[model samples]
Target chain A: MRISMDLELQDRPGQLKHVLTPISDLGGNIASIVHHHDKKTFRNTVPVSVIFDIEEQTLEELQEGLEKNGVAIVRIGKMRLRARTHILLIGHIIHTNLRETIDEIDGTGFAEVQDLSLSMPAIDGPSSAVITIMATGDEELKKSIGILRQIAERKDLLFIEPLDERGSPGGVSNEE
Target chain B: MRNSQSTLTLSIIGFGAVGQGVATIVQNVPHIKVVAIADSKGVARMPDLNDVLARKRGGQPIANSNLTALDVIRTIDHDVVVEVTPTNIQGGEPGLTHVREALKNKRNVVTSNKGPLVAAFDELTQLAYTNGVALRYEATVGGAMPIVNLIRDTLAGARVLDIRGVLNGTCNYILTRMAEEALDYDQVLSEAQDMGIAEADPTYDVAGIDTACKVIILANAFFGRHATFADVDVTGIDRITQDALQLARQRGFAVKLVGDVQELTVSPKLIPIAHPLNVSGTLNAASILTDTAGEITVAGKGAGSIETASAILSDVLSLMRDRT
Candidate 1:
């Protein structure tokens, strides 16, 4: 039930409270928080890490609430789904239309986006990103990708199929 | 032994006279409900498109003036479809079209449409197999008689030699009169039509085409062989006159358009016999010549609205039982 999130937080004391407030009000139990901010060390803003426990459904509600609160997720990890899939979501992704894209994965009832590695070329528009979705099974992982493929088919986006080409469903790749 | 339970959600296509006959049995089959009924005129479910038409291969599109059988199937969520529509033997359009749609949508089917059995039997059977479902057509032949099931299951181990019978009751009735009351073929034919046994265009029954279709159906079920209607050597009793009937009576026999199919390439002849079919009129008699039992003949009322419907119910019961 513990969710680990890596986020970019403003370098201010109560700014941490601002990010944590939405998650806490969403009924998540905050276990610990670590803030690392040094303009000379990393970047302009601080990268804060959060660890909290939540019921399975609340974890989903928390994710939705945080995303709605404009919380940019750098990474998230949970024990629910035993397998994780990394996918590259390519296109005008800065215009990312995050809700629409995430809805495609959520619609399959098999996977959830756990971690996002994003590259914003500018502050204004199009970007590219990688998404790590945790799913219950390998089939569920492919189903998540298939949903993304449909979105890619309809949009100007490109869904790079995972190089971890599953030869068959139910066979977990031994490649760590 | 509770022969009743809950209602069977049934979707019916082509709500004609034969379709009503099926619905009557559904009402009586312990616990059964007719969820939907469809026809060219209209579909008796929640209204949808005013008319939906689909053009099928090698045939004109069939028009559904209102809610489609497919729509009723989706909305009502029927478990089975009873397709009793008039058949398109050559094209197998609307009948097979609806059946395929139902099966793909995960609904079982039972029907007596000769065209689907004749042309698309293989495809339909495969679909039922893939879907883990059943498609039965006991009313398709020997209406109300268990001939197909009997030969397919009971007499499975036995080698069957031939199937010879008065398959068309209308033709049998005509020939029976020609043999007995000293009536001519045309005279008996008119009487048979008046009795509602023969169609106004009695070509199917009179010309032995009906018998041919039936025997091909029997052959497929009985021997596990694919025999088309054209494969059966057909000869009608239309030519049997009063003189022939009299001569047959003199020889202690009867003149029946008796559809006969055997192992050899054969023809239907005026096969002389001492069979007591002379007394059996307006009745159906079919015989299965087998290796073990010799020739076992079963004769009874084979064709009528009620009787055909009863056969349909039996098939439905069998399907339900097997499903459980």
Candidate 2:
């Protein structure tokens, strides 16, 4: 699982390394570490936000190790929906039950609709919509797109997907 | 000009815009000679190039010989047959027959038609190989864009993993106009038709069938996939609204009718505004993903009389070079 933790580090040399060593020692892959050098906490300690991927069972050990090292743990939370994509749909979007269309993706448990912008030119004409979907990972995002594709097919809507910037579909390449 | 030792004789089987373009270019080249030109009306054998063009421009038939296109293919002694016939995706007729006859006679064939290729890619390629003749169709896909030859000749060592691009200029023009002018699909389509950028019956280009045919050719040519028109999952740009285009533009994307060779799908895809494939107007762009070369993209006029003729001329010259 991916975790984002806010740690209050002392404004001293080797303090940032002291917090990162425990994460590395716990077999955690640190994704990012943002140091708040200018914005120090009220306690006069530099606040740093660290995000990493680690096993769920190792969470308590990491917290204990950081606490033992005198690092103040401000907050820790699981970072879900790491992958995001925007898809466009045309042709009677609302008339075909837009709520159910969004529900199909959100009910996947691994994905959710983050935002939507709709436009209807006329009362009797077709409508267009762009929905932003957020998923836990790339694979989950593909699955959510598959679910939406089927819904669009069933509802007789034209589904338009964005071409991934990686120069291939589904954000996966056959590079050796 | 390098192979100026012996003149290369060519029988242009289709006397449409592409055929006339070939004739216009061949007039200045001393090493290339057009022996026969054929349109739907009739065939002109050993005809004067200037007279043929003048007659064609005057809306008159250039039929001087009783021989048909098939007859010329069998009887005429030519090094290459330039088949620029209109595409018939369903049956691949006329062009298919012309191509088969030309290859069976052990003559090299160059074509801008996609019908015969989409209908019988494997059979035509195998026929060409077995007969020890070349079958080049650079003009078939992306007009003058050097895709088929670029992968086959220049990028010979590099393995092409996939190709994605805007294959249809008419569709691209429509989409670009729709997005840029904030006009609806119908409005831009009409404007395109009036400007002669689109045909009167723009179903083939607008409905994504033309792009699908190009994808099938690319899949068959590069990926070794025996794909057909039915193999593609196509979605045209007819339903794309101006509002959707605006929304995509607001998100820093330009909607284009992109053809994916690997996926064998031709649909309106959201391309980043800054991306190379986000080419506007009647321009065609292709991004080739390769192993050694990474990503190589080429963009040019996707459809035009002279642009398509340039590709056809290159293929003919390549055949000439191969012979020498």
Candidate 3:
């Protein structure tokens, strides 16, 4: 499983190496390392974020080893929603049962509506909304979009999807 | 390069905006002689360029010869036929017949018409091949934007994976104005019509049919897909709301009508504000994804009399050089 962790290390030279040794020694493959040297904690410790993939059983042992090395573990999170996409819907959204439309996607379990912004100009006029959907992977995100497309069609809403960075049809990358 | 020894003679069939634009540009080109010019009213054979332009400007019929456009295509001893007729998507009329007759007669054809291509791409192309003549339509898709030839010549040997972009300038202009000014679709459409950016009957531009025709041509030309107007799944920009444009703007996106050539689909897609295909106003941009050269984007004026004539001129010159 992919994991992201926040670590606060001492300002001294070997602090970063000290924290990385246990992660590598425990057979963890590091994906990224973002050191926050400018935004030091009040305790004079530097904050660093490390992302890696390792066996679930070895996570606890690695944490224990880091603590023994004087590394303050701030937070750890499993990166579930790695793929995301934003889509726009224009029509009588509220009257068409926006809750049920969202439920159809959230009910998939693999994908969920992460953010939504609605705009209604008047009471009887058509409404517009931009909904951000996050999923576990690319395929799940595509399936969720397909589901939403069907929902949009049935509800007579005009659905506008984002063209990928390469201008192809798929989820837009978060890095953009 | 022009052949100085002998002049290359060609006829302009269809004296509309694009046809007149061709006439205006060819007057400066020394080696190409305009042998005939035709409009809906009649045909003028072995015509003078200045007189044809003046007559067309004065709203007078340009007919001086008894020969029709087909008759000229059949009997005129010309090296090339510049078919700048209006697009007839339904049957690819007049343009299709002119192109077919030209190719069958072994005379090269250069056209800015999309109707003939979208209607009978395979048949017309096959006909050109069988007669061992070139049938080039560089101005058909994007006016003045060198896409068909850019991929065919400059990006030679690169495997084209897909192509997608803003193919219609009218739609792009309306969307850009609506998004930038936060105006409704109808208001912006009226503004476009008043400025002559859109047709008075804006159904073709707004309904996504024009973009769909361009998509069909690109699909058949590059992807080797035998597609037609019916093959494209289209969605127009007429129903897009100003609120939706504003909401998309807040998230660093601009709504543009993008046509996907590979998928044969045209719809209003939310493009990231900084993306290459996110060109504003009446400009047209296309992103060509290829395996060898990576993604190459091109943007330029999508429509105009002289701009479209420039593409047609390129094809004519290329044909002249090839023959030389």
Candidate 4:
């Protein structure tokens, strides 16, 4: 997966290395990088976009990782920026402990539930919402979704269609 | 204290996937430290894991901290260097710079990057010889498989007649997927890229430059001939269609991006036949034909963090066995 990191840090010596340390330090394989060196006259922060490729599973925790080092990762899309996927599960996720379910989804390293939104109804009513999972590419997403659907079916939960988010079934960027 | 287990120093100029893998591997290997790790941009050194932490997760980067490649070179008084970068087309980067720097610093080198190896093999080999050091590269030809070592050691006594096989996993993967799934060229290639089997800018693999690089490594070792990437014929999998892949499979064969180097001619073959490589997924296989050994076929995981690391580890072990 190729992640885009936007950093707001002082333009100081060894700062780029500081921002990059966590990425390299965490064993992420850098792909192509787009570094906008043009100084931002507005703030002392250097706005840079560091793009790199990493395993799908490692990325979910990557943003949280960058912010810890003070890189200021403004955004990390759950759709999986480069070569991963996003899935949504709607049901009584909180009752199931969504975090644990996500952990189970991601434990395979092939897929992970990136984010979730749950809507709980009155005390005896059914609960429902959504879970956005970022899995490894399409085939992996299928495999992961297959597992999730199985889990959902067993638990009487719901898995929605991934039509709108991802494009033509011929596959993403088929022509490079 | 000329040498300390904690201060092992090694410098890596090409800080790409393979380079990162090298650094990660060296970090896990105790008694070594990465003092300097350089890429095309610049360099940095993390003496220990604590020196750098992850920001995204607000925890720690899951990387090895004991030794950055540079620390191994500068501090631990590294006995060897490992270079892993891309192969240069007209010219390469940290691949060449790293190889030269390590050799000039009197350090043995083990690189998987064929760019520097093919472009400046003679110079780097001579530099190592002049310095009385061993510049070994076991990961050059086949990413995870030990084709280099197989040639340099296993078949050392065999009269190698020719070397050929699907050396490029990306092309092989594209072709294989096209055949099985009946996918178009573009579709399969995209999937391969997303799967991390194909390069982002897949010019090298699709253009047969990757096969050419492997052929150079094989030719130099087997034929004792100076070979260049340009010397080989280039036919990328890009031009290959599902029709081609289908024709291959229908004929009871799997189409492979074969790098054939025998008697000095490097050619690429899209063979559709029932080969061992008919085995599914991103595995790499190589066949070395020798007079004494007839033919040997080996296949295994060709890429990834730990797999590439295993190749460098073998080279390090080789160096360890011969201290003098």
- What digit string (tens of lDDT, one per residue) describes model 4 on residues B152-230? 8877899887777677777777766887788877888888889888878888788878778778778876687777766
DockQ of each: 0.00, 0.49, 0.52, 0.01
Which of the two, 2 or 4, has more DockQ? 2
Cα lDDT for residue B6, candidate 3 = 65
Q: What is the interface RMSD of candidate 3, in Å?
A: 2.0
Model 3 residue B135 CA deviation (Å) reads 0.7
lDDT of candidate 3 over A1-176, digit per residue (tens):
56899999998898888788999998988989999999998999999999987766899999999999999999999887777889999999999999999999999987899999999999899999999998866677889999999999999999999885654543475421
Question: Cα miss at B145, model 2 (Å)?
Answer: 1.5
* DockQ: the better of candidates 2 and 3: 3
Tens digits of per-residue lDDT, candidate 3, B59-101, equal 9888997888999899878888999898988899989999999
Instruction: Give one digit per residue, the lDDT tens place, for model 2 in A94-130.
Output: 8899999988899988889999999899988989888
lDDT of 4 at A137: 58
For residues B1-324, what per-residue lDDT tens digits would candidate 2 score against the true structure?
A: 222359998899998899999999889877788889999989999989999999999999899989999998998888899999999998899899999999999888999999999999999999999999999999999999899999999999999999999999999999999999999898999999999999999999999999999999999999999998878999999989999999888777789999999999998988778788989999999999999999999999999999999999999999888887
Taken over the whole model, the C-alpha lDDT of each candidate is 0.65, 0.90, 0.90, 0.63
Evaluation by TM-score, superior candidate among 1 and 2? 2
Off by over 4 Å in 4: A1-176, B1-9, B40-42, B50-77, B263-272, B277-279
lDDT of 1 at B238: 60
Model 2: per-residue Cα lDDT at residue B184: 89
Ranking by lDDT: 3, 2, 1, 4
Worst 10 residues of 3 chain B by lDDT: B1-10
Q: Candidate 4 DockQ category?
A: incorrect
